[model samples]
Target: MVKVQQSKFVASAKKLTQCPPEDIAEIAFLGRSNVGKSTFINLLSNHFKLAKSSSTPGKTQLINFFESIWIFKEEQYKMRFVDLPGFGYAKVAKTLKEEWKKDLWEFLNCRSTIKLFIHLVDSRHTQLEIDLQVSQMLEKLCRGDQSVLKIYTKCDKLNSNQRALLSKQGLLLSTNQNLIKSQHGGVETIRLEILKKVFGYEG
Candidate 1:
């Protein structure tokens, strides 16, 4: 299991211009509104309140940062989990959506601190246009380096069979397809693989 030593809320940003300095390596979470991005972060950290989670859609309207310190082999390191606002919220204006999109793009493309992008998708939804588009953009930005990992969230909501099927489908949709099908299987397996791939090994 990955261990989170220290987890705390850092700041929120409405634009890339307000992003924190690119000192610590960062990993971002992306998904459509109500996809459980915050919940997943909370689960991983073993802190239910580490990131704000809400039942209502589009509750996260800005970039939220959670700083974590991990210790392994008596060595300490810092990392950040960035909760990015979800797209495809119809209630928001087009210009506002565009602005958020621009902020996301700038953060992904220009931030040297960003090492990986965790693209979350609801397990109940098999196909998503916005998710696909984000994946494509990340693919282009990373240039085939496998910098993005698709995370199928809300696994607890699915039965065994449904989970298995969704896991298969998620792997098929990922940029580095083979990683999702390795010795360990399914979403939980994929999550560990991602931690290893991005952080050089799970803490």
Candidate 2:
């Protein structure tokens, strides 16, 4: 099984200008606060504390990076997981919120090393405006050069049948319906296909 050989905190970015310069290929995880972005990163990397997770919304106030070195077939390659701060918290000041948006936009638009953007969404709530905005931002950034994958988080909360149904319905309603249909079926199936198409692997 693929495993994260090393995962350590790299840096934090309150402003995109403050982000570190790196040439490594990067994949980012973004979602509204309390949507499980941190948990998802931890689960994928097989490191519980790799990304700080919390039930409290808006816990992450800055961009957190985890330097992940994956080991497979006795070869090693470095990967970066960017945990972007969750937006849409009602208690945040308007000025701070705007700064956060600007920071996110700069990182997504200016970071040349970013190879993939993983848009995470809560499986139970499919119609969040903030999530849609994030998706659109990634789409624009892709500019036909790269790709973005939408991941419906918290799938373990659903039974197999419920998961399948949700995936089917999500595919049917998405703009990329054909792409979803070409997969085994539904959102989870489509998610796997998207990952392969975008990142050149199922991971």
Model 1: per-residue Cα lDDT over 49-161, one tens digit each: 88886556774578898887755566565778888887766476779767767777877777777788888887777477877887788888883433777777665565657
Best by lDDT: 1
Q: What is the C-alpha lDDT profile of model 2 across 1-203, one tens digit per residue?
A: 45458788889888777777866778877787787777667756667878886556775687888887766556576778888887666377789777777777887888887777777787777788888777777776785556677777665565557667777544221224453355334444443443465457645
Residue pairs with backbone atoms closer than 3 Å in model 1 (clashes): none
Which candidate gets the maximum TM-score versus the true structure?
1
Please report, in order, the local distance difference test score of every candidate based on alpha carbons: 0.70, 0.68
- Model 1 backbone overlap count: 0
Off by over 4 Å in 1: 54-56, 72-75, 143-146, 169-191
